[model samples]
Target: MSGQRDRGGYHRQRPPTPSSSAPNMSAADPSNVPDAASARSAVTDTSELVEARRAKLSAWRSQGIEPYGKRVEGLVGLAEARARFDAEVQAAYDEAVAAAKASSSSESVDDPRDRVRVAGRVMQHRDLGKLVFLSLRDHTGDLQATISKALVPADAFELAKRLDYGDIVVCEGPIGATRRGETCVWADRIELACKSLFPPPEKWHGLVDPEHRSRRRYLDLHVNPDSMRTFTARSRTISRIRRFMEDRGFLEVETPMMQPIAGGAAARPFTTHHNALDLELFMRVAPELYLKRLLVGGMPKVFEINRNFRNEGVDRSHNPEFTALEAYEAFGDSGTMMELTESLVHRLAVASAEDRRGEDRVRTGDEDGPILPFGDLDIDYRRPFDRITYEDLFERGAGFSCREIDRVRARAREIGIDEAKLDDWFVVNEVFEHDAEPCIDPARPTFVVDWPSAISPLTRAHADRPEIADRWDIFIGGMEVGPAYTELNDPDVQLERFEAQLRDGGDDEERTFRSLDRDFIDALRVGMPPAGGLGLGIDRLVMLLTDRASIRDVILFPLLRPASEAGVE
Candidate 1:
């Protein structure tokens, strides 16, 4: 027989039967046990498994035990408990037990191993008549728990014998190694923490369908450890961002989600009606206007990490509602924001690389910086990212400058773009996106600055070159991560720009939501300081850092079609 260790001591032989005073509970009835045939069938049939679990639930109640137990205090995480295991103490205890057994003495040897209380969902269970082994899983990782019939009370032993795969339980015992050298918690006390009525997914093959994973995120998070780690990393990344901003004197603030005018960006907004004021409001597409309002209120530096809603098409890189980081710095230009963004992204990439390698492999001044894989490409986020003017890239790709309207029109038509209906600058941008953007090295982060003034309505034009706006966009991993702009704070220019956007031709749907924000113009009239503004897609950033191929994987609960529409039961 295998030796067992207890809090009081270690014993080579079977300990004395547990006393009757252990608990006022009856033994499990033999008649309640399922036959071999039925037990095998239950594994393949979820309904049968659920019925079998319900029978065990009733049996637990008959024994004067609550399957849904009360709160258990002093419980440590399974990972922490596993880390506290001491090999030297276990070896010493084993030596003493062997010494006592050789002399044929009945005295117990003092055990020196650490004891821990842990709670987790049972992922695997094996009943060996006298000993039961269970693999329990929590967010951190999985750990094994061994239950000895001779160590725990009769009722607790019986409960351990009948534990289902998904049942949550709390186990308390000393940490020790098995005779086979497997580290486990030799549980002396076990109690059911929660009775899982529904049958879980198959133990070996969990939920594999992508749609199902997103629809039932709880099960996805439970069965898939990678999903859990991705979200956990995302949370840590956001926290690090907050600390970084705070350290740089950027005050975090919250702004209105619903606004009378969605004037921040040129995107369709979700509309809602307020009964109290009988007013129509649009969900904010971006918090740029509000964050700028803070600057007008005398806040030197302000940032907001929050949700923005836009009524738009959904794709791998776009979601109707998404998280974004918007920051504004007073008395700064696009150059200032460019440096800040470069530093922030580089640091995040370095941290992510360290996490992947399980060590601090890269540092700020390291000659070979961190390189993370995104799909098939390895993105190198070294400092001083590649930079080029927008017109220069356009000329490189299209073989003509953006100022040459006839050539831009010719290239737009060659690319099947409707150049006749669109204006000259619009055609130029369309051609640029099609022919020029792809010319960039997808593996290297690059910033394209000096955008045309017509495309960036809310951006300040260059002092010498009024036709070019002082705006820049950073692209990485073939995706435009974000943009920074020298904000237009002059009230007259701001109002004129807003009117021009409204005058630009659009469908009726766009016309309905497009309206001027006189209040924002008034805020600019309050003598707001010239500032630089930035907008970053948090979901895309997480996707890049985590090496996730889709934006939905980063978002915990991405929008999905209804079950009826999606043909899912």
Candidate 2:
């Protein structure tokens, strides 16, 4: 249950056998040594290159050159440095070399290999004995650096020969083309930015094992560069969401996670005891009640994007602690929330693929296109998503209207519902979820509105029909993205709803936390505004926008079976 374990911050490289190295392992010792501060790493079973690099750290310190490095100014990214390489400048240098080679009588022009500074983690360093091809990576991207025997001072050139794969280094080089026309930096000066003893992941395969990858995401991100891109896109999506809400004057706020009672949704809660108070507190199941309190306090518009904990199942779509974006608007109801939900989602989808011109998942081409792939399916966020009523969808699925009690009861019995022992609404909900839910179109986002009044306890009854509630759930790619509600503001009705929930039980799990939500009803009694509320699962949205499948994929540190990972099943 503890998530404090290291998530692969260190990947130690295995050592090459002494039999494969020079005849005497100690004979090739260079003066580049580590300081007392940067002592030889504690892990003994590391690669020969890693141990050699450690020796260099101690050797460098002996010569007053700190192997770990210091704060040197003027560091540009490796990608930015690579972008500065001009074909004309390289061509001119080639002409100068040609002229000098043609006749010793001709005056040679200045060689393009000169001073320029860059910094990055040493991603790859293949020792060719006479030549070194080192790939360095920063946040921007990875770029190759070439070190040749003829291009550097003898001592510095030898340092390049022994550079380890994970060391961070700052190189002063001139960018140019290789013999095959691949762009690279030819460095005349190289200094240790930071010495890394860790062994990187497999060069070509990257991080493939899910458990290893999740546990060591840093290595995964570095090894598989595309992983970072997914997280980066996640950040962009959240930013766009915030901007969309803020631009519409919605105030963002925070709420309590540890509460006396978990009141927002029907689910089991993680219970803990407050030592001082000797009182039981449950981790927040939702921010609904608290968000509604803000509506009572006269904040006309508000939203919160935060985590909620539930002591329940962990699956591809559900995590113990998940992020949710909930918003409330005064003087609004389900209709208002519907409009806001559509606009917010559509804008985010449009913004997500706005930079893409092609019909692919990754952004490319026109930068104004609307195609973002989600698991082999390219979702079009060009316009408003499809909308349908809950009854209509259920009717389409069950082959009869939900209002026909006889058909509903018959279908429920066939679908494994024990009708003789179940309440009408519960049976109906079970049937709807089991049958109608599958009818949703997987590609187009759809909202199923006007739920039965019995199931939607927190929502207001429909203005046109008292038997139905003003609630709607937005489904995209066969997943529930969000739900909107025209809230019940009357204190008496709110209290009645909460009390009624306690009277009706779904199963043991729901019974554990489905008590009368007194505090929320109390807030309602204090004159809460008639409001529209919306709850969006931010992590799921990020997963949708980024095309990540598991809820754990988007979460930085997801809950996992213990590393002693035995019988999780």
Candidate 3:
């Protein structure tokens, strides 16, 4: 098979099987063949293919050329090089060449085409005897390089002709368009950047297997344009969030990633030992506690975008490690946090809508509200996101009031939840999660406010209703995007709630990570202001905006099962 690589640096190849046939190699000495190849016929075909690439590596070494490349000066990216192509410059150069030819003089005419030096991995290569054409790709985009044997040095031309599909190359040339209307670089000089020892994937069917894509993401990034674009959008999305927050007088901050007690959230934490201190530590499940500590330290407004580690099961929406954004504002309550969240999400949605236009995706064409597509749903991000009370939704969904202990227990048991072991409010919350959450409109941004105080240990109790907390959870595209709280700042109340949570007999997994943070209670006792706090799932938010289905899709390098573990599948 001809190995013609392209910007999508892969070619199709089935893993060698026992029934596969190997092509005869005339240049390979029979005695020099690996004994394992003859011993195990199943690997013979793969061995032969590998041997061919290895031979090229040997030849390059014998010619005194390094297989790897060094930093080359004055080299531009492929996209930048392509951008330098100008129609007027090419026409002028063409006219000058024509005039020189007509005069029949030995004098050379000044070339008007823009000159650029560029480098990238060879995507496509064709050797047409005296001329060679190579397509190169960088992160920005791809460009074609046309190397003429008559124009370039003899040695450079020879190198171009023999270059393999995956080899990286640097070339200098005048930016011009081909006769067939393809923009290209007409190379006067070329150099080998690196010699690739492995064959690239098949050009027509590049790294298609999803499992293979995640495992070998390096290849996927080069081959899959969609993947590169997804990550680019993700980066821009994060930067926009940072800028948006900074412009609103919020100071970005960093918090300790490891803590003696995982006090932020109820999620299980990954544990580790600090050998020097002879003490144990857990990777922070959330930066909430520390961010609040900053508020206690006189920071009026603060936010952090960072990684949090949790011991959790993997799913389309969940990762063991994920990014979260936490913010705290002094003298603010749940209502204040709600307003901030609405403004931030709406702004991001508008930005994403503009980005969708750039990506050429279908738009709803409603300028009054920017609608972004998330899977099959077109989520509208108009002003005044729908807000409903937790009690109202639970009453409607469960067909009973949230305070109905008997009905809540019956519903929990019907859903196969063990109501006997858990507390009454816990059972009610379980029923609400199973029934009430699904009632939310997937096509609209919503906030479910006024959660039960018992379920929100860190939130302030409602002034009128002692059983309900002044809290709200934002949902979009059927996912809980984030939660906001009028934080509990009273030291005695906070301590009482912490003790109640510890005695709540949470599941074994939850109980393992649940513990009191004495220092955090001490911070509360130091007279912190009544404030609002928020924690958002940044990855999930990006997934909604970018139309990515899974958290893994937006994550650059998601945690994956080992190859050996995968082979068993």
TM-score of each: 0.89, 0.87, 0.87
Candidate 2, residue 472: Cα displacement in angstroms equals 0.8
Runs in model 1 lying further than 4 Å from the true structure: 1-46, 359-367, 565-569
Clash pairs for candidate 3: 5-123, 6-123, 10-201, 10-202, 11-201, 11-202, 11-203, 12-202
TM-score of 1: 0.89
**CA lDDT scores, all candidates in order:** 0.86, 0.78, 0.84
TM-score of 2: 0.87
Among the numbered candidates, top TM-score falls to 1
- What ordering of candidates by lDDT runs from best to worst? 1, 3, 2
How well is each residue in 213-292 modelled by candidate 2, as lDDT tens digits? Answer: 78878877777776787788778888888998999999999999999888789878888889999999999999899999
Which tens-of-lDDT digit does each residue in 373-492 have in candidate 1? 788887888878999999999999999888899988988888899889887888999999998999999888999999999899999999999989999999999999999999999999
Clashes of 2: 17
Candidate 2 worst ten-residue window by lDDT: 3-12
Where model 3 places Cα greater than 4 Å from the true spot, the runs are 1-47, 95-106, 362-369, 395-414, 420-424, 508-513, 565-569
Q: How big is the positional error of residue 305 in model 3, measured in Å on the Cα after superposition?
A: 1.4
